[model samples]
Target chain A: MPPTGLEAVFLANRDKLVRFLTARGAGDAAEDLVQDLWLKVAGRMDGPIANPLAYLYRAADMLMIDRYRSRRQAELREQDWAEGQGPEAPPGTERAVAARQTAEQVAATLAGLGERTATVFRRVRVDGIAQRQVAAELGVSISTIESDLRMAAHALAALKERIG
Target chain B: MSQDRNSPMHGVDTVAIDWALRMADPARADWDAFTDWLEADPGHAERYDRAAMTLLDAEQALAAHPDVPVPIEPEPVRRRPLRWIGGAVAAALVGAIGVTAWQDRPQPYAIETAAGQTRRIPLSDGSVVTLAGLSRIELDHAEPRRAMLSRGEALFQVRHDARHPFAVQAGAVALVDLGTVFDVRLGQQTRVAVAEGAVMVDPKGAALRLDAGQAVTVEGDRLIRSTVQPDEVGGWREGRLAFDGAPLGMVAEDVSRFLAQPVTVAAAIATRPFRGTIDLEAVRHDPAVLGPLMDVKVRRVASGWTLEPRE
Candidate 1:
């Protein structure tokens, strides 16, 4: 059968997607990533998307993020294993200490933000509540909630940089 | 270069974060504008990726520090219009009448299984239910066509009757068999997978029809549908547990059901995604074998076993 909707769009822009992924530093895996994108689009059961092209690009971006995460996790695991075998300290102790420190830093960062921004971040991120509902509960507009989340994200980015 | 608020690059970071937040709601995202922004400059794509990664890291950090208390106000009671209140009163009166009729029906009895045990229950209507370990199911002898799985997992080979459809309720979600063999697992999320024939998930709400080699995971009000291998639906019955990017916490829960002692996962690696098949029989004898299979350190705690990240 001929492709339709998102599938059709994907087929026409397959090369463009490959270019995009390559430009985004996918390197040799650009083709494979494009294939994965095809599989995702083919398996999707949802109705027609509002912007098929943009949706495909967004999905492609997320795919890259997932790849980066798994790769980073594997590297961390290997590094930890190597470090565990060293004579400097006992195995797994450093990981626990680092985790505790990161947690403390995250808590301090949240505490340092404005009360409203911190509350909004907690309700939306920690509690998993809808931003619109949180806005309604706080007697604020959705844009206000979005702005608060942005501020929280900015603070977190700074924290991650410091931790690094 | 310094990344202070006054830096020229700070504007890019702010816009990137804003875009990331907006893109969280994919259905309503202005993707055209986002793509335009991304294509406007190569640095924009890089900044956007960092923003997205930062958000994810923040979520993980918060998850790791669950003990950190953030004061939250109690939920406010929503006030309904007078017309809606009157409608609700009438609906309650009708529900009371229905309850009176329902009270005459036979009570549903519960069937439970301990860890490392499985029970095969043959219903009166010719359907067979294979309840997994550490699971519970409620069945009514008088009405053999209905069952409720309160926890854990079960495989149902439903005998389809066009006049009397077989229905299985898992939490708020309900699955009605349409000449089907399906597996339902209840945990932090509800999962329904059809092995043979078809099933209707959430028949009263989304009413999604899933056929063979199809599955759906219901989390909150969202129903995410995906494809699954038909033969792998009840692989646990064959001493194999298959996972495809399932969180370690959920995998540990499944593994715990097959052993005399429960398997516990550390909070740090609880959300780590694992994809592989575990040999339940092998792990049952020596839980430490999970260390190699799952790339984690398995330590025998006082209670049972703990799976921690290799780190």
Candidate 2:
């Protein structure tokens, strides 16, 4: 069968996606990333996408982010092992400590923002509620919810930089 | 916040953040505009990536800290002090409310076991519940005789009391122990097998009484009754699963509980019936062994193993 919808877009822009991945520092793994992207797109049985090209790009970006996160986690694990910690230490002890610290830092940062902004962020991000639903429940406009999310994102970006 | 929005880097960062957020919801994202912005500036893509990463990290942190307080609306305050007679009436009302609240309190706690792990919990009533891997059972401290198996499998050895009988709720069906030892596996269907004594399946509904060595699979409103060997009722506890004409999908689900990785059957063969005893240890060592053992083709996927019919 001929490729259609997102699959067609993906095949047509395969080279562009590889270039995009390489530009995002995928380097040697760009081809592998593109393959992974193909698996994701091929398995999809959803309705027609509004902007197939843009969707592919965003999906590619997400794939890269996932790769980065997994790599970071592995590095963290290696660092823990290299620190000469005893092997008897329960698994995930270091992860739990790091997670607790990050959680506390996030709580403190969100506490500094407006109550509504912090609540909005928690309801949408932490609680996994939809943004539109959050706005409706909060009796605010969708634009208001967007602005609140933007503020939360800005604060979190600063926090990440500080943590790094 | 307004001052930060006015900064030189803010223009690009704000738009990038907006794009990142919009992209999260596929229905709302303007991909054409997003693509244009990315091509317009090399820096825009980088900024968007950073924003997305930051959001992801923040979400992970919040998730890890489950106790992070969510600010909910405050309760309404009472404006007037109670009069002497009114105070007595209010105190009586409070007492009634307290009793109701005590009885209607939420499920006190839940016990969950990860995949490839099992937990044996002995209740205050001398009943022992052995939960299978990848299973969750919710119990109320106030009521130890009741349990709700939300997912996975569990073996119940009840210290049956005629007055306060042990009841297990799996899906829409309720199994009340009639002085019995039974195993209930909840998945696409709820399967219950009695090793000893008897149990009433859905007293209010079908009210089917399953005696020793009797098994029933509850699917929707239908109850499929069959006989099982008394010894093999909860044989999974001994790492032995004997299926007699069981669907491939159900077999996969049962096997998946014993292995750290998931075992999934291809859609084409998902409903195919299989009759056999699978040694989980051998499959755990080499998932590919299942292909020859079950006379099917097993392909190793990134996440786990996928079973397919031999072509």
Candidate 1 segments whose C-alpha is farther than 4 A from its true place = A1-164, B1-104
Instruction: For residue B169, give model 1's deviation from the true position in Å.
Output: 0.8
TM-score of chain A of each: 0.68, 0.71
Clashing pairs in 1: none
TM-score per candidate: 0.45, 0.44
- Chain B TM, per prediction: 0.67, 0.66
Q: Candidate 2: which stretches are off by over 4 Å?
A: A1-164, B1-107
- Per-residue CA lDDT of candidate 1, range B67-122, in tens? 76543332122322212212443343234335543455776799999999989999
What would the per-residue lDDT of candidate 1 be over residues A1-164, giving only the tens digit for each residue? 89788888998998888877865558778899899988986797487787788889878888877776776667666787788853333359776677767766766555544456677887887677888888998998887687677656666765665465
Q: In model 2, how large is the Cα lDDT of residue B5?
A: 30
RMSD for each model, in Å, please?
23.2, 24.9
